[model samples]
Target: MRVVSRLSRVPLPALAVASLVLMTVALTLVFYVAPNDADQGFSQRIFYFHVSIAFTAYACFAAGAWKALRHLWKRDPGADLESYVAVHQGVIFGTLVLLTGSIWAKISWGHWWLWGEDELVLFLVLFLFYCAYFMLRFSVDPGPQRANFSAVYALFGVVLIPVSFLAIRIAKSFVHPEVFTLHGPNFGGWILVTYCVAQAALLLLAYTLYRVELTGKRLDARIRELRFA
Candidate 1:
């Protein structure tokens, strides 16, 4: 059996420093080591971070849902807060995805926003849907009821993800009569390494940000409690 107490604790500052170093190295690899594609050229370099951010956003949402489950199922004390923070991070990354995706679209196509872009449209829908979560959360009084509502809403958001993707796929069959195509570059050795590094760096960055935000929130709550006491 594995010994749970055998694990050593790593400080948040150390994690933050490590994340920063990894990010720097990953960025260096992205700019210096990865080759420009013959098809998309230098603009394709954006794919490293753009796609990575999108994946990270998905992960954040999944994590939020898991925390929400904990809040509802186990009645975990801090699970609601953790779930909110994860959703918050997901929204932040989702916004980045929209911005970077627009840039990529412009670079690939001659336009900034394409109405026929299935992925873009789906992301926009999800972005708006999750943005409403903040409104819903703040509209209610803070208590167990709020926690239950938030948990249920977060679960809905996760379910919406795959459903939205499917809806977009179905819509694409008839939506765009003339399809605009942007192909990803073939992944060679260095390119694959750079992508993996970039992905790891972004995930680490997201986790560090989540930890920082959660810490700030906990501190705020403690201060409020002390003042009231």
Candidate 2:
């Protein structure tokens, strides 16, 4: 709890600066340092960005679900808004995943989208489900009922994440390449380092954005309360 409180107290500007620096370094490593794939060539470079963003999206969803659990199970006063903001960040990153995945498919497979791909289809379904969440959330009035509904919906998303992630394995017809096989990782050396850097950059960027949005929302709520009072 002390650790969590310390992290929460980190200044927004500092986070923004750190995120920018890491993101710049990550992009430089991806484009310049990482070796080109012998097969896919330059196009394979997108894998660094695409996969990292997808994983970051998953992290955001998972964080949202955990916050939702806190709201419901522990009745944490601030958890509901935290969950909402996290899910919002997840959806933003999820959209980027689809865009990046489509670009990758176009370069590798000569198509923008492949409906037969299990991983692609599952991710789309997961994204759409959360899109529906925003609709449901906005349709209801602000109160405990809305909070409960959003929390339950976020919990459901946590269940979907694993299913979407493992779709390539669960479905025999999937053509998506598995990076982590039973033997080991498919790539190594700078490829691994670049990927790790990219992942860290994206996660930091997402967290920074999450904090910014959450702070703005809290300020707005406070302003409204003051006006009403």
TM-score of every prediction relative to native: 0.94, 0.90
Instruction: State the lDDT of candidate 2 residue by residue for 132-164, as single tens digits.
Output: 999989999999999999999999999977777
**lDDT of candidate model 1 versus the reference:** 0.88
Q: What shift in Å separates residue 12 of candidate 1 from its native position after superposition? A: 1.2
lDDT of 1 by residue, 1-229 (tens): 1331221144678779988998999989989989989898898999999989999999999989999999999998999999999999999999999999899889888788886776677779889989999999999999998889989999999999999898887777688667767676788898899999989889878988988899999999999999999
lDDT of each: 0.88, 0.87
lDDT of 2 at 94: 88
